[model samples]
Target: MTATQDIMNSETLMGLLAGWGITPPLIEHPPLHSCEDADRLLLNRPGTRLKNLFLRDNYGRRHALLLTRSDKQVDLKALSRYVGWSRLGFASADRLRRYLGVEPGHVSMLALVNDREQEVELWLDQELQTGNDFHCHPLRNTATVLLSKTDLQAFTDHTGHTPLWLPVPAS
Candidate 1:
């Protein structure tokens, strides 16, 4: 596969993660285009499902992936203060594809693997990792993956990203 194809292909991503020893059980589902859609679809699946916010800094020069629980309402103002982003806004689709190799709803920790430039900062909500189990898209939204938080952390470590834990205030 070409470099771009390798980055964007979900099956390729699955193989790539498996090589890294992240062998989570894959659960297939219909396309989830919104938070409500995901919640409804993955209802029976237990564990901490994250709300990943792909954002751009005030200058649009920096990118960050903020992962918090599905229920928590992220205080973007507070998050910006913690991450040192003077301001934050949703990143464009082009930027998302360029940096993460995934579209908006398809984002997950898996995309960290494609950040060859290491330009994306990962901001994790501290409380979300309380349990050992977690849920995330495997670089695609049509499926869900159940795995250990440690395994996800391992993937991040392997990708050379040390997630910055932000003390996300409770809802």
Candidate 2:
């Protein structure tokens, strides 16, 4: 799995979801590298749009996938304190590929499928728990997948990564 070729792609991700009986709706669009792109292209799409961050502790000993509403601004310093981690920072592109198996722009909770070792921890903004459904990239920036709360939970269970739900401080 060292080569980029080993990373899961959109089709593979969709197949995995289907195998789990979790067939969520997928919408294809131009590649999106930022939340603004998502806002401009998916403005009318239903569900809670999300911003996924792949971060690591200062020492790079731990990794986490933080998910929050796209509009919310997260205070990383406050988040570090809340999670009991030394100053958190965005992980490097190499680290992102090594751990989550996706490049920077393609990160999403669904990428947990690549973490067979269960190394990356999942963290969800408590505020988002109220949403009925959420939108995520299906391991590619060119598409979006709409998943219900139940479907998300099932996906996490299948991946053996239980998310830590917490109130992420907004900057």
Candidate 3:
């Protein structure tokens, strides 16, 4: 929330992507806050979608965006062990704004673009590496973007973010 930056919403996200020459197909729709909402809104356009979680470490010093398929369940203990974090828990709306610049039900990997401090690390499910039809909100829940993994990689690289690929098992 800087003076020059007027809230890192989808418009800002689109501009940033354009600067990087990354054009992700935008699918405009009603605001979708949950996986079920997304599933209902964007029917027949599913492949590898994401559920971005704004998380903090046990002590609340470290933060991360845990991006996994909307279907996969998480085991915090295993995830903590994998990432060497003592424990993992959801961060609050205030913390999300402080770090990733988004609110609850609006958590998306693209929000990482606003993390200029590089404080929120990106943790992605390894299964995402095997998909081409990737969809995610562009910092806003009202719209979604279907982009190639290469473009997503480019965006991540442009943001100086190298995701920690993890194996998120099903529950």
Provide the TM-score for each candidate, comma-separated.
Answer: 0.90, 0.94, 0.91
Residue-level lDDT of model 3, residues 61-142, one tens digit each, is: 9998988878878887788887888788889889988787777778788888888768888888988888875778888887
Residue 49 in model 2: lDDT: 88
Please report, in order, the local distance difference test score of every candidate based on alpha carbons. 0.80, 0.89, 0.81
**Which residue runs of candidate 3 sit more than 4 Å off their true CA positions?**
1-6
Residue 107 error, candidate 2, Å: 0.9
**By lDDT, is 1 or 2 better?**
2
- lDDT tens readout by residue for model 1, 1-171: 125544747788788778888898888889876578976764577676778889898898999898888778877777777767778788999888888888888888788878977989898888875765677888888888886877877888888888888897553
Residue 73, candidate 3: alpha-carbon lDDT: 80
Query: Which candidate comes out best when scored by TM-score?
Result: 2
Predict model 1's lDDT versus the native.
0.80
RMSD of each: 2.5, 1.7, 1.9
Query: Candidate 1 clashing pairs?
Result: none
True-structure lDDT of candidate 3: 0.81
